[model samples]
Target: MLAPVDDVVAWGESLDHLLECKTGQLVFENFLRTEYSEENLLFWLASEDYKKITSESEMKAVAKRIYAEFVEVDAPRQINIDCVTRGEISKNLSQPGPNCFDRAQRLIYGLMENDCYPRFLKSDIYQALLEQQ
Candidate 1:
């Protein structure tokens, strides 16, 4: 549903990363699965470097920057075959904490071992990209 000329143009030109209807539904399911897992919301909240912001504007800005810098450029396939095969996406997308990165690394390694697409991230570049905005 998201494949089209307009989507391509919009993605190139805009920082907005709002999910389409179908994608939103899928994300909602993933979120639910994560929330009910052994490691719940508080687990993620505890490990966050910035646990709380002083202002609503700051919170929105952080979300905006994260969406623009990480989600946009990496085009990280949030929903993937590993997510499906392991039944992880249905129950792991919401496992809150620094462990999210660790999970991604594990998935990336698995994909590489299987000769599939590799996902990688450089923290320095991510910092610079967020800073520039």
Candidate 2:
């Protein structure tokens, strides 16, 4: 992971742009890891995956797993979300749909877009990469 990344410049375009690019996601993910707040990105990623399930049964199973791993109270990698958002996700658990995590996902997206992403652009890691590129 230490290799100098190409196309680093494109990542600064926007959060969506960064998330969409494979290399951008890695760079951003590594940046988040250093801040010890990788959970937000991880949750956001799980939400994306949850949205792609084709079957209702499969989607429900993945939803519960996503909740257990990320949304539930005391989840091992519990994301920083408000009780209302958390409660909404909890309410949808039993008959969860693909969009069950939508609210929490949007909230986390806002957190990353407004907070973490800015710092990432300013981080030594990103700066050094820019210098390399």
* Candidate that would win on TM-score: 2
Shift of residue 116 alpha carbon in model 1, Å: 4.7
Clashing pairs in 2: none
Best candidate, lDDT: 2
Worst-scoring 10-residue span by lDDT in model 2: 1-10
Candidate 2: misplaced stretches above 4 Å? 1-6
Each candidate: what lDDT?
Answer: 0.32, 0.87
Q: Write the per-residue lDDT of candidate 2 for residues 1-133, one digit (tens) a residue.
A: 4433546776777899789877778888889999998889999998998898899899888998888998888999889999999999989988887789999999999999999999999999888888876
Report, for all candidates in order, the number of backbone clashes: 1, 0
Q: What is the lDDT, from 0 to 100, of the residue 11 in candidate 2?
A: 76
**C-alpha root-mean-square deviation, candidate 1:** 16.1
Q: What is the lDDT of residue 20 in candidate 1?
A: 30
CA lDDT for candidate 1: 0.32
User: What does candidate 1's lDDT look like per residue over 21-97, in tens digits?
Assistant: 23422332244344332122112222243335445555455534433332232333232224343343224333323
Error of 2 at 99 (Å): 1.0
